[model samples]
Target: MTTLKEPVLTKRIPTHPWGDPTDRKVVSYKQYVKTDGYKGLKNALAMEPSDVVDLVKAAEVRGRGGAGFPAGMKWSFLPPEDGGRRYLAINSDESEPGTFKDRLLIDFDPHIIIEGIAICMHACRLDTAYFYIRGEYHHQREVFEAAIKEAYENKIFGKGSKLGQINGRDPDLFLHRGAGAYVCGEETALLESLEGKRGWPRIKPPFPAVAGAFGRPTIINNVETLAICTPILERGEDGPKWFQSMGTQRPEGAPPHVPASFGPKLFGVSGHVNRPGVYEEELGITLKDLIEGLCQGMLNGKKYKSAIPGGISTGVLGPDEYDVRLDFDITKYDTLGLGTAGVIVMDEDTCMVGVARNIAHFFGHESCGQCTPCREGTNWMSKMLSRIEAGDGTTRDLDLLLEIAGSMGALPSGRGATICGLADGANWAVRTIVNKFWDEFEAKVSKQRFVSLSVVGS
Candidate 1:
């Protein structure tokens, strides 16, 4: 089994295979400082902020928030510090089902992320940061809040802090609870929710880097994304090269600018795996190795049926695709981009139609109803799946399911822009399931009273 030379982000937090699970516990501020926790921040303080940004860019730290965008480039996107109150929005609203990696960090190693937040704010000159955690994280809210208090106590923020003033303001971080809407997980929608408005996506080009969070320059990053900055900076000059050495290298002939899936990622494996839990592994680890090695094979020795490469949003990997690598390049297998890397494994006894049905229903309910294609398309897919799962579907229902999913206005070929990625996720998810399990869906539909039906005029 492949393993990192040693744990980086999961160093303090115990994860499977690498460390004994029973040894896990919350690391307090005192414990954190003693273990060289804030050393990364100290390293940053000794260097110019632009140099830090350049260092992270050199490391090619990809956003661990599923999108996998480079953190350094994102930091550079900010308009020059004009003595304005630039903002940082840490997306801790990890509401996506099967995605629990962020929660694990908040539950135990909150200080690492706190340190990361400080480094990012310092580097980007973002004076204020809002940690937008999902409301469902009731206990986690308290845990993280207490951690932030620890940082304040240690002068991580507030007046007289180690960071001092940047862009005419003392660096500060605040915790903002979400209203438990899934759509608010989107960057623009989260910004809107933070503004005390409905959680709906905003039009882009004013992309958060330019104007966000109360209409100022803003930067949004996921919890894991920010947490990783700690290690990169801690290593100082050697950090970037050290990071690139672990994960799969750039494709043989790919351009230098094309981002490689570098660094370790926290994959929350759930569903039918025997050892269903989060594990930290370098990018490009094969799904087969993950399931067989870290996950300890399927539960009860059942065969693997399917698995979601990341969250339900990224779509499923068929049994034949077990060897597919888990990384940003996962889309080459036809699923959506590797999302949060929150994998959901299904066993042989599991029903594929029901899987698609549950996923469609979730998206349908969670959709904010702002975009017509996503709203109508997702709801239709849900109803059709329910019918198919119940054996009340016709041959035409299967075709229409694919058609509606494909036409969901998520991309250029569809109706129009989906505002946020809800439609894209929903479409790719259902479409991948149907395409991969065509035989299963067809058999279920064949049991119906009608084999074929003409479209009814609307």
Candidate 2:
């Protein structure tokens, strides 16, 4: 077992990690305009489009989304030759459980995202874009829509607007809200939802870049992925450089600022802690720092036994892995992908079986039902977990789940982009839970059976 030094608690959160003042008296409309918020867009106008791409690549400002694909690489995927109307879709559907960081960006700093997306569209030569928000965030939707209107009224985004005047060209950006569906958080599923479809994922090889919404080349980026553009362009290569300056300098420990493969992950800490909010720290911060120091430890000095680090899909971590740094390379230390970067902590009272079952149930509902493997696999995993929690599970059932999950794991892909990562994510969660907490689950079943016999005798 890896022993970690105790954590240090702090009151202040880093500015980039959703640290904006929420309870303010001033109108957000006036506040953003006064702050010179659109300065990045102004700077983007002076440079050539490809120069924007080169600047992002040079600064190494990778995506904040779970996949951590390079932002520059994704932009470069836009057609070199003007094939047709390319689209940029902002993935604001924050449905991933525990991942609440993006909600803060939309609720507090909507204009910043707007400016970032506009600049991104300019760089990609995209004429139209969409801010695909989750439907349940009605208040966030209202705030975001109002900000979009404010930007247009101030001539920041529409054709012949101040943004156009600065960029020397005009483009269109629109806001569209999605009915709450966790599957829609997937890029391809999001594209399906945007096109007035039922939101089922499509197979890959013909990635969205090749055949996307309305059969046009498209780019689906996360909300934070777009927000980083503000600093990227504002500093004009210096912006992202300043961001890269913060956090640990080690290449091995998590991907510092931006790894060659993965980027800085925006993680949020919640559950049984003093400061139960969010932070945009580097990928390498210890889990102990995240839950104990940053989140203020378990509430009322309670003992924390485990935590679901990363979205519901990343699997749970016990005290043994507490010292492990938060990063994309979660594959090390028995962790899966650090998805969506939402850390849900569990105190000593939390039931490991119940937690795993709850997560399995969540995926069961969110499966897009397009591919048979995901459609059937998620349901089977959910049922297996339910049976185990209810004491109806056998040793064979546990083995059965691993088999199903193994079959559902990413196939040896000849093509790159698959429908969505939903199936693979579901498999990871089930496999991690079953592998790590097998003894706990088996013990639960035994205890429940004994209680049943005792009740019958009584």
Best by lDDT: 1
TM-scores of the models, in the given order?
A: 0.97, 0.87
Best by TM-score: 1
How would you encode candidate 1's per-residue C-alpha lDDT over 11-73 as one tens digit per residue?
998876668878989999999999998999999999999999999999898998877899999
Off by over 4 Å in 1: 413-416, 449-458
Clash number for every model?
A: 0, 2
Residue 240 in model 1: lDDT: 92
lDDT (0 to 1) per candidate: 0.89, 0.71
* lDDT score of residue 333 within candidate 1: 91
- Could you tell me the TM-score of candidate 2? 0.87
| lDDT score of residue 113 within candidate 1 | 97
lDDT of 1: 0.89
Per-residue lDDT of 418 in model 1: 81
Model 2's alpha-carbon lDDT is 0.71
RMSD of 2: 5.8
